[model samples]
Target: MFLRPAARRLRADHPLALELAVLVLALAGAHLWRRGATALLPILSRAVRVDGLVTRGLLAGALLLAGLVLYVGVYALLRDIDVGLSVPSGRDRRSLGLALAVPPLLVGLTKLVGDLTGVPYNGLTMSAYGVGTPVPAVLASLVPGLLVGACSLTVVCQVLVQGTFARVVDGRRAAFLTTVLTAVVLSRSTGGLSAFPARGKLALAAAFVLSLGLALYAVEAVERDGVRYLAYLPVTAVLGLVVVSLIAATESVAELLFGATHVAVLGLAATSYERTHSLLVPAVAYLSLLLAEETVVLLFEAGMRSW
Candidate 1:
């Protein structure tokens, strides 16, 4: 089933001290390395600003390499030392369609509501931007690499924040931290919230009702698709939004919420992985979200140019 939680209870055979020590050491090194690498290549830090194909391709490839080495290395090292979770051989695939399809619709609905009400919710990732991503040449040249790199980066974050930390900390706290950490990491790279409104009383009411409807519909759609635990994705995002609203100033809410939602989506993917032991669920979802998002952006940009 899609979004099913893991059937097994938490195991604690590994030495917590060793696992944490290694993870901390690796993070320190990774931060240093990222600093140096990004200094040499600004594209690593700001991928969305570039429209050129070569720059985008290089950026994707670099992120893919870094993410793969970091995550695969940590996972392998832990597994070798008997401190890691093994990759499951099982697979569950019923949720891919919803995963691929929902992000764009949600984003589009946010866009539509903003157009009507003049207030938009905060948005999500813009690094998915690729000029004419559907163009055969663009698709062949940079899209695949970017898609894979995104998946790699996302998975690495989850492996560290969710898989690793969950072992040492309580699940709820770990989940929250996962959002906090991921928001910090991605907030800069991702663009702001769904878009504007809520400035005026009328606009606020419209945005709220429309957003609520979309949220409710999204959850219902997930349920109708037979997803169980994963349907709570919107609620998880709310948790992130609430926490950020309390701690952050109003201006920063959208960017912070972007990261929170990003983490929530990945959490669903992680749950799928836990239940089935396959990576396809997350990869497909991310790829779809990007394509769907980019398609929306592309058409909107095109419409604006003509308008």
Candidate 2:
């Protein structure tokens, strides 16, 4: 059932690459046609519309570019850290310090720009609703989730680097990093100028402590045993449910992959948890959970399309 042989033949012939290039050209042409067509349409209203085509295009492009830049930048930054992610040396505390500094910097910049531009503060929407409630609101709310997820993943990624991928062997240290990462990311996202005051700082602190403690313990256990994946059972179940729901509703492959990327990173953590009896526990646990979640969703999609 493997496609490697076929893939090799196609690759060697360079046919698949040419087809991919043609497909991309076709898609780009279609996108420009649709966009320009909509923009060129004659105005039919007697009322003065404040928002014009140029404004709409600019807004769309800016939002898209911002999201892309954030994704690439965040991933690259995490990749540079010496957190022993893929292999473990000692925890590169310097890299850890730098890693911890990132989310706040992002938060500050986003807030400053948002305030200066008079953009609506939508950061609180993640606490109040899931992405399925309303289409526009769901899409709008995803930005914060993406930002928060990026920050959270960085911690988790660092934990993976140090505990599983890197030369470090301390599971608890990895867990500590995990908790710190989560706290820092959430704090940055919640407190900056756009944050809501409803939860209050006291509550945030309490939540952080509870989350940190549990996360640290979970990681420590999962690193040492394969069947010990139970530490992340709650997270796995919740994320699995979310993935299943999205697969049932969304049609776009890009959206599915984007949603699943979070799950995939978590899965990496879970895998490390299952493999190493050392401090890599929580990382493996999370990675396994993520893998299960995303794989289930992807399989379901495949089945649906086959039918």
The model with the greatest TM-score is: 1
Q: For each candidate, how many residue pairs have backbone atoms clashing (under 3 Å)?
A: 12, 40
For model 2, residues 96-187, the per-residue Cα lDDT tens digits are 33323433343334334444554322321122232234545433534444443343333334432233222333455544443333232223
Query: lDDT value for candidate 2?
Result: 0.36
TM-score of each: 0.53, 0.22
Candidate 1 Cα errors over 4 Å, as ranges:
1-28, 39-56, 59-75, 79-91, 119-134, 169-185, 188-260, 303-307
Question: What lDDT does the true structure give each of the candidates?
Answer: 0.48, 0.36
Candidate No. with top lDDT: 1
RMSD of each: 14.8, 23.7
Alpha-carbon shift of residue 83 in model 1 (angstroms): 11
Residue 162 deviation, candidate 1, in Å? 2.4
